[model samples]
Target: MGKVAWVFPGQGSQVVGMGKAIAEADADARAVFDAADEALGFALSRLCFEGPEEELRLTVNTQPAILTTSAALLAVWKKAAPRPDFVAGHSLGEYSALVAAEALSFVDAVRIVRQRGAFMEEAVPAGRGGMAAVLGMEREALQAIVEAVSAEGDVVELANLNCPGQIVISGTREGVKKAAERAREAGARRVLELAVSGPFHSSLMKPAAERLAKVLVDVPLADARVPVVANVTARPVTQAAEIRRLLVEQVAAPVLWEDSVRTMLEAGVDTFVEIGPGTVLTGLIKKIDRRARCFNVHDPASLDKALAELA
Candidate 1:
């Protein structure tokens, strides 16, 4: 078998009842959810399993909820199959990857991400900032547009470099709108606004990053048992000090997801198993490297399928 890399999904991938099926079928998965509830001092699993859509979408709730679900699925995988050689995650999902790599405990990760989500939401006022995806544009072109627009308006920066032709920009609402228009004019095929409560992974989130830096000091981070590709640097971070620094910078830095995947591939990771609520990372990995094998374990059925394939 080829070297395996386990990936996790970030925000915007959460949905109601995401881990219910797995929880119902697997005692270990249910235990993971139960632990999250105890750690968060709330019914996060309830909200995840029985969301009103709006409530589950709240940043504070969504962040911990998704982390719980992903970690739960990862627990099932570890119990059932061979461990991955490497791990990576998008934005919020990076916490999940760290937990899986034994760099951080699952309970600590859940609590921190809950704070992370709350900090991000409170960083900028709701109506003041936004994010948009610019499709079919090269990174250099998008960077130029962001630079040109930032010169005229509030800070607009690249947030997520998801794949070859997809990049998400975040900033002040007006600045993002201007950047989107400029991107379209600069030959982008489409610029679609994203549905998010706050503008994340942009310079406008510096305040949040500053706050999260303090929180990082309290969380215990150990040397990663498995290499974890970082979001800001697109490189494997094993040292605890570097992990803390990159995680803080990641709040206001571009999520180098495409590059992260490429870096993992270069490091001998040919198969990717995404342990999360959705197949978002799996899809992006496939787009980044068609020859790379990818799989997602979201629920009971998917977990069974993945175990069978891996076994």
Candidate 2:
């Protein structure tokens, strides 16, 4: 009844067997998997369908795995649903959104993300950097805590503005610990350190962003067929050059997810179809605005149900 925006999930949403059902049920979906494997020169599909869990969870493997799976499911669902008025994704999920918007080829996207993951992994040495989620705290209050900590040389900063009362911070392990402590003392409901490989979405990732920019230089990017709400700016982007620049910057920039959602809502997107492995984005969207319709389509059953409801 209203405009539609198709959003995708990022890391931490990846699960083994993510694309198996869709690949088995749709020939087009299977091709997406095959193409990713060929591009990456390995059986990434096998890893996604049958994971050791440990290997799949690695940042390098998780990036491509989630991108391929989301692309495969999109292959199955795109024909049945209306073309989205806009597309957006969380952090790593931005590649999936670019693929969906036809701004980047699926093969190029998978390869780029794999390299992106590697760069991010190498940006910070193991155990030195970390991230944490803070709950029930206002952004300004959390910002002050992060600023005070960083001013003292710990270098923590807000990473994800996910939704009301939910924000993620990233930086050195000591910085994260200090920020978490400050947040808790400031009356935050909770602050949990995340088990991640590095401090993503922080200035600590600048080295990774630089490496990724070099990798993207030769990759062909096309103007988006549909407007893609960008993670760095929380605004619609269609130019290939602008998207390319944003992709590089997004690595070290906070994901303005809440603002991006609000932008879409203002653009008349009352329905959101999250086409990925988990309901993470859907839950966030509900927290952002409970009245907006949300649906998940990771498998044939969910795909059919969403299509029916949307129709």
Candidate 3:
């Protein structure tokens, strides 16, 4: 039988009322949300279930909210489904993957992600940096443009290599703008600016990464029970020390999402279960290989569908 992998979604996958239904029906899931509230000393559940949209979108709030919601969903699903053989997550979702692998405590992961979001926002001034998605372009072609733009005194660089023909670049506003124009000139299908607080996954986030390293030092991270495909290296890592170091580096490094998916595929992961708020990762996995079976569990309905299918 092909091995199974559990993946998690990152920031853009979050939505208002994401975990409300599952949490309301499942005590285990509810407890996860409650734990987050106590850890953060606020009603993170309320913000997630009843979002004002603006507040929930804030980086500090979004990170913890997504982590808490993903954990809550996992609490419900793990009760019925078999444990994943391998685990991975996209960008901020890496913390969720660690929690799934028992590498990071859910409580600690939530708190750390909250702090991480704050540091990222503080790293670059508002409107100073941005990210944009470039479609219908090869990585090499777009990378060359990014390098050329940065060489002209801007700092744009590849951020998320999501899949073939789809990549995201991050850097200063002017740099991103220049790169976007150049990408268009290079025959990119489309270039859309991302609605993000800062230029994440870029060298501009070095300060944020440094602060995160110090915070991680005080946090307890155990070795994983399951191999976790890291975003920075696109390889499975089980050592706590190595995972900790990669977590710090991931802040300013490109998310090798496509590479990570390919690694899992080569390792016989034919089934991918995305246990989080949205189906973003599921779509990306399908894009990587149409033969891959993908399932998403965000609420009670999705949970039922995935459970029945997996069984």
Candidate 4:
């Protein structure tokens, strides 16, 4: 009887051969992959179904690949799942959420994400900028540490506010490295460098944001069928023009994941369905509010499990 939401996962959830099983079992899901291959003018489905791992991991390929997989999964999920009350997604997952909400066509979503990935990679020279996950620290303390490091003339800043005690920071190599040291000294449980190509979701990604703005301008957008919690604002945004603007700004802004989930809960979203490659969002939701119901549909097994839970 409570409101429900469909959330999607981002980059780190990708894996080789992610959607092959569902595509084989469902015609709708297969069409999603076929459309992606046609739109991109290459066998992106093959790259996802049978990846070389190395190529699939490239930011350019990874972006569209994850999008395609999540779209395919959503196609199958639609067969039995009821209409969701609202929708949201993590950093890269925001595009998936938009496509689901009918704010953007799937083909347009895939195309721009490919370009978005390349632009982000090109924004900062490889090995010069990166991200690290700092656990067991509060946001205020972490923000202060990042600010001190950035004041020394580097671009350190918070990237993903995933959940309490789990924050990711991004910036120049020296900035991230120094911040990690400071976070440890400040009593963080651990600081682990992430395997990302560049410093995403930080002021350093402004060049990428500039390039992405042009690509988003001509793309068709519609008011979301359901409210979509924006990553930049952690609030609902349904207007097409405003969605376009926030998307561009999202490139250089920290993902307010915790706040977004909390907003949904405050709006009475008691159940959350993660329609993507992994259970990352489900885990985050549990951490944010264990009383909220969480389920996910990735592969057939997970799909069945989720349906049973919903029932």
Candidate 5:
């Protein structure tokens, strides 16, 4: 059989009442939630199980909440699913990937993301920065366009290179608006603004990265048991020191998601498993390489489906 890869989702996957089903149904999954609550010194599990919607959506809470939920789902899947040969995550999902690799403990990861989110939110005030998705535009052309937008003295840069034609740009609000307009002029099919709290993965996030570096230096990290594809370079990362540096860089760097997926495919991974609150990574993997099989384990039913196929 071809190798299997396990992936995780980032910010946008969270919804009210995620992880509740698995937490109620399994001891391991429930313990993950309990551990998260204890580590973070709050009822994060309660927020994941019964979100007040807005509070859970806050970037500070959202980051740790999604991380905890993804970890909980992973704990459930590990009961039956075989160990993945490789792992990767999108944006905030990278921390979850590290946990899957055994490079970091779930408690440590949850703590880091909570602080990371707070730093990102604190980096730029509301309404001053933004992000927009440019569809149907090639990378080279979009790169030139974003540079042109940056030349205007506002900081605009490529953020998420999610797929072939789906690229997200982050910058000052004015800069992003101008970039979106230029993208439309440059023959992009559509330009849509995202409802994000700040301009993540852009120069505006440097302050966040600086703050994250301090947190990472003190945190304990081990070598990966499974090779982890990094977001900044789309290459396999195993060393603890390099992982620490790349994670800090990842805060303000474009997510090389397409390249990361391709790297695993080249490494002989043919099945992609997304264990998280949603199937976002599964869809992204299918878009990157259609021949690869994709599965998701969010709740009991989906967990059974993935187990039937893999276990």
Candidate 6:
């Protein structure tokens, strides 16, 4: 059997009709959605299934909705194939990863991410912070530009090291704008500002991380049945205490996604399966390692295809 790793995507991957196909086709998948509603004490499934787009895009709602959808898709996947040897998620998807690894209860994961979203949103006021993706730039060169443009009052730092030639910078609005200009001068092909609610995965979010630390203390975590590659360290985390610490820190830390994928590849994860809405993680993995096999499972047809390929 191929050494397999299951990965999940974060916020931007969510869409209006994400988990509807899975929920409609599979009873187990529907139950996952129902459980998420019970856990969050709201009609999250409704928002996901029938969204006005803006509400679903909110950080607090998006986090739990994406987690619930991803988890529901994973439930369908479990019925189709063997469990992966390892799991990982990008940013918000980390909660989904922990659930898949058996390190966190599904209901608790939902609640924590909901709180996490609220904290992140409230941490940085509207228009005060922003993020941008600097494409076709080396990480070192991008970092140099971010540092050069940063001022005493403005803070911009590399946030997501997604893959080669792609890096995200997040911080104060002025800082990000300056970094975007400097990045172009530093040889970036394009700089696209993100439509996000906050400057996530940057040191500006320290206060949010501090608050999450307290929340994590009360949240239950268990030893992972399968190792989970963490976004902060890009290493497998199994201990409950370590998981809590890393998750708390992850709010204000760079998402070491490229490093995480590289670590899993080095650890013999040759096949990557993205169990979520979009093919974003699969695209990122392909960019990291051309030889690695990666696929996505979001609906019944894709699930059958993956099972056939793996079988």
The C-alpha lDDT values of all candidates are 0.91, 0.96, 0.95, 0.93, 0.93, 0.92
Q: What lDDT tens digits, residue by residue, belong to model 2 across residues 1-311?
A: 78999999999998988989999999999999999999999999999999989999999999999999999999888887768999999999999999999999999999999999999999999999999999999999999999999999998999999999999999999999999998999999999889899999999999999999999999999999999999999999999999999999999999999999999999999999999999999999999999999999989999999998877
Over the stretch 100-210, how does candidate 1's per-residue lDDT look in tens digits? 999999999998999999999999998899999999999998998889989976689999999999899999999999999888888999999998988899988999999
Cα TM-score per model: 0.98, 0.99, 0.99, 0.98, 0.98, 0.98
lDDT of 4 by residue, 6-66 (tens): 9999989988889999999889989999999999899999999899999999999999999
The clash count of every prediction, one per candidate, is 0, 0, 0, 0, 0, 0
Error of 2 at 73 (Å): 0.5
Q: List model 3 lDDT by residue over 218-292, tens digit each.
A: 999999999999999999999999999999999999999999999999999999999989889988899999999
Report the C-alpha displacement of residue 260, candidate 2, in angstroms.
0.4
Worst 10 residues of 3 by lDDT: 76-85
Instruction: Report each candidate's C-alpha RMSD, comma-separated, in the order given.
Output: 0.9, 0.6, 0.6, 0.9, 0.8, 1.0
Error of 6 at 22 (Å): 0.9
**Tens digits of per-residue lDDT for model 6, 1-311:** 45899999998998998899889998999999999999888899999999979999999999999999999989878776787888999999999999999999999999999999999999988899999999999999988878876755679999999999899999999999988988888678999999999899999999999999998898888999989999999999999999999999999999999999999998888999999898999999999999999888988899889889888
Q: Model 5: clashing residue pairs?
A: none
Candidate number of the best lDDT: 2
Query: Between prediction 1 and prediction 4, which has the larger lDDT?
Result: 4
Model 5, 189-239: lDDT tens per residue? 999999999999998999999999999999999999999999999999999
The regions of model 5 sitting more than 4 angstroms off are none
How far does residue 258 in candidate 6 sit from its true spot (Å)?
0.5
TM-score of 5: 0.98
